[model samples]
Target: MTEPNSKDPAPSPLGRRERLLLAAIAAALGLLLFQLRGGLQPQAPLEQMARRSLELPVALANGRPTILEFYADWCAVCRSMAPAVEAIETKHRGALDVVLLNVDNPRWAAEIERYDVNGIPQLEFFDREGQSVGRSLGGRSLAELDAIATALIAGKPLPRLAGVGSLSQLDVASTPVAGPRSHG
Candidate 1:
């Protein structure tokens, strides 16, 4: 048998063409997985939204107030409000309805319109009958949110902070109002 020549360069561990193709395939798979992850994750279904009108209404109508949080993944305000909302949900567990609505879903456009939501982090309070009783917009502290919930439960108007606007003012047209409305 002829000995291999040491002067000849050894073959690459992987051919250049093969390496490029493998990299391309890997990149494609990575993108596919990134796109599919959201769908694969456990999320509230679109169909369940209709039930919000029915089930949530009934729950609210039965003397159990419901807290509806309209949020979007891209919204900083929504992300900031998440923990406070979670805390409120935990505090009032069996007594109130705490639901999160992803406003990014086109299916929720109608509900968004119905609620006249113009921004992220919209919190709506509904009576057991599903009638909207109160609303608060923007990020709030747990104490601030709890106070709103408390006022709703007691049928009292939300205490107005010196600079903060009322929930009604959070609507699309009213958002231009200047200054912070107090929730205390």
Candidate 2:
């Protein structure tokens, strides 16, 4: 047997082939983890709708009935109702327009005020003429949304729903009746 040289450096515990194999394993694990993470947390339906929703102005002016939803990302009701909204949008595509506006975003501040959105999940229903006919506050079930969509597509009156209110014109243009003024 040959004696070890005192001045020589010790050999590496891992050979080049072993090191390469370890690197490959680590890379595979990293890739798998990344893929798993992505697969585990898919994008929510609300996010997809928000990304694909038509702009408010365009939707209202397109001559199609519009369903404008005001929501926040953190609102539980909005999240829960997103799937139904998405379904309605899909079912009424080309005949009706569905628009989603995030209330938390400052870009929609004007719309929020115009629609008197005091709560999340406020839905404003507009006719084909771009006139707002009604609004609904709070979350709605799939059946309710579908019914509303059907009415809009058929050019009929929206179904009476809980938390829903009509936007009708007042008699503001009529001449005032004679009345005694009290200045006391």
Candidate 3:
């Protein structure tokens, strides 16, 4: 064939439709990668369970109550507990120790198994010697968490059924009321 005319438009690159389709596929792949990366990455700092070393036991041995929370990245209850746990951290700063352990991490997986964490939002209270004094599993409301913290600080036994109750089953009667109700 005759040499391509110099002025001829370079063989049409990808057509508009082809370009659009390629772009769409690229965008879809990008979105998929982003989602996969997010899922694989650790949870956000505020949302992540705190990690502590064995030194935690030494701190507990100093006669302070320690709150140890075991959580996973995909757990909705764990995410819900984030704010309350932070509030507890702030409220009991220096008085009560708080530690978060990510069960997804292999380093703490043994502890997770040892503690028998079958669900998200596993809360364990440790005495001065690092012994587990009490534990509550599943979701907990702010008030219930506060009560548990208070009990830990006071060296009193945490109510067995207090924070472990299902949210669907929680009712006005289940909550602890401080003031007398007015029937009038």
Clashes of each: 12, 0, 1
> Candidate 1's residue-wise lDDT over 61-103, tens digit each?
6777788877765566666566667677678767776777666
Task: Give the per-residue lDDT digits (tens) of candidate 3, residues 1-184.
Answer: 7887888777667889999999999999998988876756745644343643224556568777888877655666777777888788779776788888765555554566678766667778886566788888787877887887888888888756643543222122332333445221
Could you tell me the TM-score of candidate 2? 0.69
Say which candidate scores most in lDDT.
Answer: 2
For every candidate in turn, the CA RMSD to the true structure comes to 11.2, 14.7, 13.5
Compared with the true structure, the alpha-carbon lDDT of candidate 2 equals 0.79
TM-score of each: 0.58, 0.69, 0.60
lDDT (Cα) of model 3: 0.68
Best by TM-score: 2
Give the lDDT ranking, best first: 2, 3, 1
